[model samples]
Target: MYDFANSGYTTVVITAVFSAYFVGGLAKGAHWATLAWTSALSLSYAIVMLSMPALGAWADLHAGKKRLLMLATIGCVVGTALLAWTPRLSGTEAVIAAMLFIVVSNTFYSYGESLIASFLPELATAQGMGKVSGWGWSFGYVGGMLALGISLGYVLWSQAQGLPASHFVPVCMLITAGIYAVAAAVTFSLLPERAQPRVDRGIGAWQQLRSTWQGARRYRDFVWLLACTVCYQGGVAVAITLAAIYAEQVIGFKPQETMVLIFVLNLAAAGGAFTFGYVQDRLGHRLALSITLVAWMAVCLIAASVTTKGGFWVAAAIAGLAMGSSQSAGRAMVGVLAPPLQMAEFFGLWSFATRLAAIIGPLAYGLVTWATHGNQRVAILATTVLFIAGLLLLLPIDMKRGRAAAIEKSPA
Candidate 1:
């Protein structure tokens, strides 16, 4: 339910609707919008990268995941709701405000993701981790699909009523915020916290972070997992951050067409998430991740080479499949490897790795696009290198050894 709630924010406000709207409608053009969007994302992730380890350590020490989750969720909801007002004003000031709103909301959403993920190991056994993670991802994608559908329906309905098309974006943002708050209530009500005693009540954030850093050498497999995740997720972040803009700019998709494309992608992604979850458990995380990385490479190649809309659609479908599978497998791997007593701290490091990827990937893509005068195809293809790098890193990881180390180190 938490995943479902957050997915609405991600899909409606970040990925499917507002990003393109920000670029096309608010930021004035793709070139500036892309630069602004990437900058905002880089700033947000930089904050997360610096703070996540401390936040995770604090959560671990204080047993405060649920509390932190609630706080982050509220932050996202409020930030998204405020976006509805962005369209009411027009000027350089409004554009900057809108971008700031997106950055703040996305930061909260990312923090919520990390906090909720820390609960995974407590929710499922190691053998069942893949399925549980997959279910969460599938559910999130369903939420995304539904959220996009709602936004699309609103846009169509407003047009049928002869309302200005410009009014649709704000209304959709409101709907997204409402959906997130209502759906997230279920998560807060039903999910168990399973609190653990504070292991280091006196531990300061910096000390905890430093200890986590030093402990990496002792947990080599977990460190390797983080390295692999950083590379592949860098590729994934590029695809997610740029997909809508890519469709609009490169493929000449209208806003309505882009929404529909995202809707279909969400459906495909749900199936991929579920299937890969089963594969993760049966075939193991490393194999599942490798398969997804290979699929991502194909997606990048296809996206770069495709000229026709139909070809792009095909690429989108492949991307959808790989995106869901890769993310689900990566989260499940963290659950499988994190020491039971230090789940939040480990997942914090997970967030750091992911946030770093978030920073690097979009910046790289945006910089390349800007340098080439808005040539997004080359930038899209460049992500293939990230996936290849990740795949090479994954090949050396020993999943069994990682799991064993977690068990051995766990205080439980």
Candidate 2:
């Protein structure tokens, strides 16, 4: 249900509505608009990477993952709502304000996302982790659909009434923040806190970071997993961050058409996550993840090759299938291989790896687009190499060794 809360923030604000608004509406006259938006996102993700390890350590030390989760959620909700005020500003002021608010909102949102995943190990056995993770991820996409549906409905109605984007888009921001707040409220009310304060070690976040680094080689596969995650998830970040823009630029989609395209992605991704959960159990996590990577490569190839809107839609659906399944598999893999006492900290490292990927991926695309004079096709096509590198990295991991290492106690 926490997934239900947060997906709205990502779907409406990051994926569907707000990114394009930041580029086209807020920074309308700038040649560097796309780079500016992507740079803002990269900066925010860098903040998360720098902060999450310590935050995760604090959550574990005080048994405050839920408490921290609440704070992050509230921070994201407020910052997102604050974005509604950006439409009222003009020129560089509007652009600067929007970018600042995005940094605030996105940082909190990313923190909440990582903190929530720390609970997966407590909720399910190792054997059932994949299925449970998949189910949760699948439901998140449903939440994305619900949020996007209402936002899209409002947008269509406002368009019919001849309302401009400056009017309707602010309302969309309010709607996104509202759903995130309400859904997270439900999560806080119902979810039980299971992690007890660590009485054995009273170290600070920096000490925890030092200890984790010292013993990193002991959990060999986990380190390799992080490397793999960085490569593959970089590609996923590009897909998520740039999809709407790609559709509008390459396929001649209007803003409405882009929203509809993402709406379809939510539906398709929900199915993919649910279906792949069972497949992961039957086929093994590595195989399931490999299948998704292969699918992602196909998606890039197909997307790059397509000129017509119909072909693009097909590529988008394929992307949805690969996106949800790979993310679910990766999270489950982390749960399976993290030490029990250090779940939050290890997942924080997981978040760190993903956050790094988030920075690298969007920035790479942005730089390419800027260099190419707005040629996004070559930029997106280049992302395929990240996935290929990730797949090759996956070959060296031995899950049995990793699981054994995870179950043993960490050193004093």
- How good is model 2 by TM-score? 0.98
Error at 224, model 1, angstroms? 1.1
- Relative to the true structure, candidate 1 has a C-alpha RMSD (angstroms) of 1.2
lDDT of 1 by residue, 1-412 (tens): 8888888877777778888888888877846679888889889898888888899888888889999999998998999989988888886877888878988898998899999999999889999999999999999999888788999999888878887645999999999998899999999999978977576577776787798687777679899989888888999998888889999889989888888998898899999999889988999889888999999999999999999899999999999999899999999999988989888888999999999999888989999999889889999988889999999989878988988988895566
Residue-level error in angstroms, candidate 2, position 40: 0.5
- lDDT for each candidate structure: 0.88, 0.90
* lDDT: worst 10-residue window of model 1: 196-205
TM-scores for every predicted model: 0.98, 0.98
Model 2, poorest ten-residue lDDT window?
A: 196-205
Candidate 2 lDDT, 215-237, residue by residue in tens? 89999999999999999999999
**CA RMSD for every model?**
1.2, 1.5
Off by over 4 Å in 1: 199-201
lDDT of 1: 0.88
lDDT assessment of candidate 2: 0.90
